[model samples]
Target: MSATTPLEPAASWYAASANAAPERPPLSGEVSCDVCVVGAGFTGISAALHLAEQGLKVMVLEAACVGYGASGRNGGQIVNSYSRDMDVIEARFGARTAQALGDMAFEGNRIIRDRIADYAIDCDLRDGNLFAACNARQLKGLKEHQALWERYGNTSLELLEGDAYQREVSAEGYTGALVDHSGGHLHPLNLVLGEAAAFESLGGVIFEHSPLVSLEHGSPVVLRTAAGAIRAERVVMAGNAYLHGVLPELEGKSMPCGTQIIATEPLADDVARGLLPNGMAVEDCNYLLDYYRLTRDNRLLFGGGVNYGGEDPADIEALIRPKLLKVFPQLASVRIDYAWSGTFLMTLNRLPQFGVLNDNVYYAQGYSGHGVTCSHLAGRLISEVMRGREGRFDAFANLPHLPFPGGRLLRVPLSAVGAWYYQTRDRLGL
Candidate 1:
């Protein structure tokens, strides 16, 4: 459970469809850089790309291959906000802070679009994301959510109910949906690979299979890996859930959770179109929400269910296929093409945890399940902070984080108990 432990990427649909990327050599000997980043996932690569663009000498160290973690294996939905919604932020941090955070909520989506266009990333980018409601209560929640987002100047949201919902998606159970035109989906692994290429093109250096074993912080912090070491004027830790035991300070604030996904064999084009008429990524409004979308090759990718302690299920397909069938029984006879699970960090309040260990060491993690866009935004904010522009970064850094209630040994059980409450409510249609 340490970041330094060598791990291979899961045999996921994303891996099978990933773009061919050159193997980056592992780090050897000693190297010096203006900034050294740990964990070559979205946040690390993004920070490296932005910093390299600013002419800063940057080196990224990855415990495994690029995008080997959740960055590559996620649902690929460009969800445009924090795991904890803005209303929660407004209530907890006040309207002023909520306003600031709300403005930046969709910034990550914008960053992804800009990166795709500027670098010509071939990630099968699509437009539109839908939040489906499974019951009357959930539909009411979506309506309130829409109004909350509108108060923050997001007018791209549209409500779909009854026949309109059926028109958008052929799924039988959903009562309504909230469509966000600004959100979308794509090939996650390919997108990360393309971004890494863009980063390297900007003079950034990356070392794969090189995990940080120890750190010596000072004016020039030193990071030691198994075979090599790096001395950087500044350092950024972007490992999130997989950081493992590398940083003790972060371990207690966030707990790692696992989510599983399965892809069906390529369906007929007509069937795929029927499943999602508008071709939008969809997630339901449930505690352990179900999310699904169609791959470019016409396979259905459905994911849900979580393990609070980050344990992969024995049979991922068996664990999730029933959930898929509940939403679309027609897929019962279809063969599953692939199944995999990925871990994401969840904070006590379900918001991202951002702060500095010292003046020279900055870290961001705990995006829960919403890291796709938030991690990219974290990269931009990290780069800005490094450049002495702290306004935007401080908005998030200022948000307080509480450690899990029961420490490591009890945290998982305690979380499971709390989750049961919400899951029961979801099941009862409350």
Candidate 2:
């Protein structure tokens, strides 16, 4: 009901360590293009790059600086698969849908690698990710997950137990782990910024600090910002949780939630090597999971905890420091250099919500917490649809998504209650 203040990018470790990005002027006057994209994060930049490669004129509009949203602020793990796993998709959406999704499960990982190589975008690309299991039950689940993924041609997964787990991660806790050789980690902010640069190199135009104010849908969609307007043949909405009040139809389908992370001062090479022996990104198997990895400079970046109402905690370090200590008690004396929070959108089904609004308007949002790789996949799929290859896009768009219960008023509270239930199960080791 009331206008909220705009958010500036958090003073995160990623921001501090980011490569220098040239300042791009904001929109000022009228501009027309073949396609106008809202939100200059990964999805928008990726889509713009792909569309431009196809010789289409494209323009990207960002509410803040590029990668200022979750794209730049995320934990930086290149985790493959969706928020909902393949078995869950098979059970709920049927085997046909699961099969279709399975075919693309690893495409995101491949896209990230190909983009880095093709564009020579430097983002500290590495080669492995680990999933740690807290208890025996979680270890069993990991085994089942490995087998299920193998059925989908993910043969790069290797299950580890006992001494093997300890060898990979020198943590005190964790019964076992699953190493995904294909998945990895990177500097997310740099990755997005590099992609944005690549997009511009393709003759695509981008305007930063140009938030969308209003939209008039018709034969040629007209989108207006405070000081500028764009008339385009088509529009792409990739703003996700940060998109507020632009479209009424997207209101109740997803709610914004906050997640925090802390980065410790660069550890000694020996210390960093001791923490993760093989230098793989790790995430514990819990509903409220803890994911940590070593930055290129060896700073231990650890993240966990969530706020369902999208409110940042008074002290992000205080809230997340304990979680980090729990995993690596050896880091009890480590100085936390940076702490920040970012928001991601969650849908009722935990699956991404993708569909067409009008004949020429398309949207892809609600990646939940599994956005890093999926956002890239979304961009490619969206571009394909625009190019008349609709099958892959339909696999996701056809899935049904329910509105959050209680609409705007009670959705946060209801979701919090649900989260608590699952978190309790995670705690009880059920």
Candidate 3:
């Protein structure tokens, strides 16, 4: 079965309480368009939105419902930057590439905000995202993180410690936090769903439940769905982890990793305020970190525990509840209202993989758990490339991606071992 073949998304809170949307019909016959985008998630939708705005006949083929993958199931924090920060990009790829990327480090955040306002997307948009320190080691790292981001010209960060930090997240054991006032959280499913509506408003087409079964790359690429085909002047592969092995070339370029999340029953007004006085979404500084935030309706949404190989854990709550309690033990009694897993593509270097395949087929994937905003930025960049521009896109396409150190079979185990090492360091405070 295709990875995107899940008849229904996992029983996520987002699915249970998703915004009202029409059940779009699946593609049933051959069609043609200026641009054919695979996957109706954030990137594909964003790309189609931009292209359609430019008056191109854009059609998005979705394997599942809109926001059915990581776009909807994530912790919903609009965290900025790639999984590997700008400093790492500069250190390894040099000041030039890093500078190019640094310019767009926060572009994704801006794109999301603009879409929310311009399209009047009612995704319950709010602001403020925090990075908490689990140890003194991580605390000091936050200081450097601030300096690095400041170098890139973002000044919306505020560092808090002791009483200040405790007031923000009324939790235990955190030393300090760096809050990006510009970063925020939202109802992810609603966000993407709204984007799809906006895309349709601009004359774009979306065929739900139409999975790309095969691709014929050429000047005018041909994509075959189970029941139909699309002959397009250009094609964009934005499926990411859920795309699975649709394209042979993308198979070895990254590994799909699953992460789980659970939502607690809504807390009383006072109880909710006490948990997060300011309603800021948060993530930790560990190698394998925990991320959480209070939902718009006052429920605590916490998530972590990366299970490599895109396999759902036997018990999602059992895997994530302990980690959630470690940060906010007071929630131990809070009933878990929902539990589910979504896979995100993880490349070896923790950078996104963006480049051309078979000449006319352009692709972008492996957000490495930072898809929320970066995917939007990728959409703009990739759309520009399709429109005969390549300057900004090259900053990402130029990055080299090596296959997982251990080929297909051992890649999962090797990645788990590497994650274990950093997790050990986080625990030992080394």
- In model 2, where do residues sit more than 4 Å from their true spots? 1-7
lDDT (CA) for every model shown? Answer: 0.91, 0.90, 0.89
Q: What is the lDDT, from 0 to 100, of the residue 8 in candidate 3?
A: 82
Give per-residue CA lDDT, model 2, range 282-371, as digits (tens).
999998888999999899999997798678999999999999988888889999999999989999999999999888999999989999
Over the stretch 1-430, how does candidate 3's per-residue lDDT look in tens digits?
1434786887988888888998899889999999999888888898889888899999999988888888989999999999999889989999999999999999999999999999999888889999999889998999999999999988999999765788689988888999999899999899999999999998899999887788877868888888988999888888898776678677787998999999999899899999889898999898888899988788899998788899998999889999988877877788999999998999999999999877678888999999999999999998888877999998999999889887888999999999999999999998
Better of 2 and 3 by lDDT: 2
Model 3, which residues run further than 4 Å from truth? 1-4
Model 1, residue 57: what's the lDDT?
94
What are the C-alpha RMSDs, in order, of all predicted structures?
1.0, 1.4, 1.2
Residue-level lDDT of model 1, residues 251-323, one tens digit each, is 9988989999999999999999988987999999999999999999999999997899898889999999999
> How far does residue 291 in candidate 3 sit from its true spot (Å)?
0.8
Clashing pairs in 1: none
Between the candidate structures 1 and 2, which one is better when assessed by lDDT? 1
Name the runs in model 1 displaced over 4 angstroms.
Answer: 1-6
